[model samples]
Target: MTRLQPLPGGLPERFHVAHAMEKGASRTRLRASDLSAPFHGVRSLSLGEADTILDRCRSYVPRLAPGQFFSHETVFVLRGLSTPEWPYVPRIHVSAHRPAREPRTHGVVGHRLQTREPAIDVGPEGMPIENAVRAWRQCGRLWGLDDLVAGADALLAGRHPIASLGDLEEEVALMGDVRGGILRRSLALARPGVRSPRETHLRLLLVRRGFPEPDVNVDIFSTRGEFVAEIDLAFAAWRVAVEYDGRVHAEDPRQFARDADRWAAIRDAGWDHVRILNHHLRGGGAPAVAMVRAALIRAGWRPGL
Candidate 1:
């Protein structure tokens, strides 16, 4: 773990500026300005994360409109709020004070504050990024799920925890978004390394397409209390088990043998099974929804009025 250098006055050191000068100086001829104290009087704040934008704009302070606050996106990066897979966009939101201008041309964006909402104070530096991430969670309700997820990704990848981002994402996801689905919340509940990537994708697709959700990685056991098989996705009442089979399953000889044994064990326990391939779920073949729907119908899923 990289120990964060203790910041001066609890403010992030301008690491971005330092990184930029280092890069520019490395290229053949260095400028006179680069030799001088380019960061004179500029208290460089480290966002506690590394990035190209952070490197380029290290010397520049975000130009904010009079009373605008930092949006979830900027705060997310500054605070380290999300998983590494999440994409980070360099933008900040400022609340619209007077009549909003026609999208100001600054690098930072001015997002109108929700009516009657006061600005939330982002805490001091050197405090765990998690605290700022909590503030980002609150900001997401006014913004959207995409922003929130992006924010969470930035924070988490930068070494913050998912727990610190809080539960607002789950709450909003439950309420449904433009697509009238709850993917955000479902993703929040997904445990890393527990489910195969294929299984996780299928589960998300089912939820997105409005299928009856299945229990992920449910356990199966014999009447004699012996463990039978751990299903990838299971419906207990229907006795249906959906397994996501990846290409690796077909390629690896050892994995194939283990899978054969697992399948035999499952069959002996008298459970119905349906295997879906990753290509089928993710590619342009029979759509994931159709395949799942067919399986459910064959297993006697009644249509609701």
Candidate 2:
């Protein structure tokens, strides 16, 4: 018996099964344990576990037919929006517009999208993908109210924003009773210029608890017209500012000193500043609301019925 010839090296990292066979790969060699079938009719050189979502996405790219693109939660991660940290890997969300058969493979949650709705766009990887508006709208399939708002804020206000408040409003109107009104409620509460999901949570916690909605990331100026600071959640009318200070990044001494000076200046300007940390929002967020409420009251805000 002769040892079978190894597969050709120049066949590309991920190759279609038919293409490999046409390139002189023997059926026996193609069926060997050396190649793993990540999807039907597509094989890959071992990328063990495919731990990250993008890796898994690329692994399945060979099988994506025309008109099919990534959507929903997958787009959230791919586009760098905040999502709940799961202990295990989540399935990829693949989608195609109406009349197309959606994928039903393991490790995939396929969506049959509305025809010509929730528009599509190209992603950073050059793959066909759902636009940020569509992704934010589709997240209603799996996300809750606060998360939906966070995702909305990210799409409309993040660096290199893909949508505007008008875009979101348009999408929500088209949704037409999606989630039995969850999308409508979230959209009404969603604010632009929100920097992070934690900020969204903080804002929602206060409003739901009867505090007035705060202006998101608005600039505050001193009596002399000099910019004092941009408060994360500014109650400008009452001279109160609420900010979520989740500084988990590696400390930059220069940035820290600048922040220290900024905080001091904010206080010196006679604005009541409420600094909210991770623990303040850990549970029911009552503490965060209470802290903001105290600051607002100190700044002369009165509750109304």
Candidate 3:
């Protein structure tokens, strides 16, 4: 038996390699022994080079005699659940598979891939199995939480689940859970009939930014519940009704005229109406929240919760 030379700072050579690379070493390579630590030291190979880290690792794929591997998060990134924005790589939550042993580094610094699946699928980028499994798992959790709740609510109320992806994002942000974002994205892509894309995105931004959630397509009715008017988003308590006032509203003469009539009717019925345009959504979320907050405050909402 031979004792391998331990990497500097008592870290595995791969870990050292990854650490050094992250601190701005543009060009570096590793030998097999550098990855010979427990769990085959896959973390050492993870140098933060976003697009090419996997590509660089392919050189050793043909040499993966046995037991050598990559990290699970790395696999997920390659598959696309998380975008690489530098500093913090998107964390993939995969608690489904149990690891036989602990990883060398707990997070982005360096870590090993521990999965229950037998025989990882390797390619030019190494294990596609890891990325695919993680992506699928995240997607499942997302649908299980957000989509199921929203879909069930919509169905029971006899409402359509055809909402925008942006709106789904906001709902997910509000719930502060993976389940929400996943289901929202999945449902929006699969179903075609929900709110328009822009409206959905605006809805999402509003909710994610800690503003009070607004009702979508709220129907104002008579005291007998006979439908009298329809509004895009409404804060009934504040009597604040908001319309998207989109390009269609301005482009179509009939729609423009009808909108004026509708606002007048809403005013007559004692609702304070506020109209928003696409540009407002694009520029001033904080202002929008402030305006809404101000109105809600005037209507007797305590400022600090």
The whole-model lDDT of each prediction reads 0.50, 0.80, 0.47
lDDT of 1 by residue, 1-305 (tens): 54333322423334333344444423222222223222333333332333443342343342332444444445554544342232534554434434443235444454553343343454333211123433454454444444444444333332234443335444344434433333354336444333333455566566566667788677899768799987888867777777877656687899899988888778677677777875575453356567667777777886562
The TM-score values for the models, in the order shown, are 0.46, 0.87, 0.38
What is the overall TM-score of model 3 with all chains considered together?
0.38
Candidate 3 local lDDT, 1-305, one digit each (tens): 55554344443334433553555443323354334322233434344433454543442333233444443444444433233234533442222233443233332222333354644455343343433333333334433333333332232222433234445455445434453355545444333222443444545555666656677777786555566687766777777676666666577899888878878878776677766665576555565556656666666655445
- Model 3 misplacement above 4 A: 1-194, 222-226
Cα RMSD for predicted model 3? 13.9
| Top candidate when judged by lDDT against the true structure | 2
Judge candidate 2 against the unseen true structure and give its global Cα lDDT, from 0 to 1.
0.80
What CA root-mean-square deviation does each model show from the true structure? 10.0, 2.8, 13.9
Error of 1 at 72 (Å): 6.4
TM-score of 2: 0.87
Worst ten in a row by lDDT for model 3: 149-158
Q: Write the residue-wise lDDT of candidate 2 on 1-305 in tens digits.
A: 66768787688777788888888898888777778777777788784656788887887887787778998888888877877544524458999988886788887899887777546777757767888787877778788888888888887685667688888778778766477888878888887788988988888888888888888998887778899888899887888888999876428888888888898899888788888998898769878878987887877887783
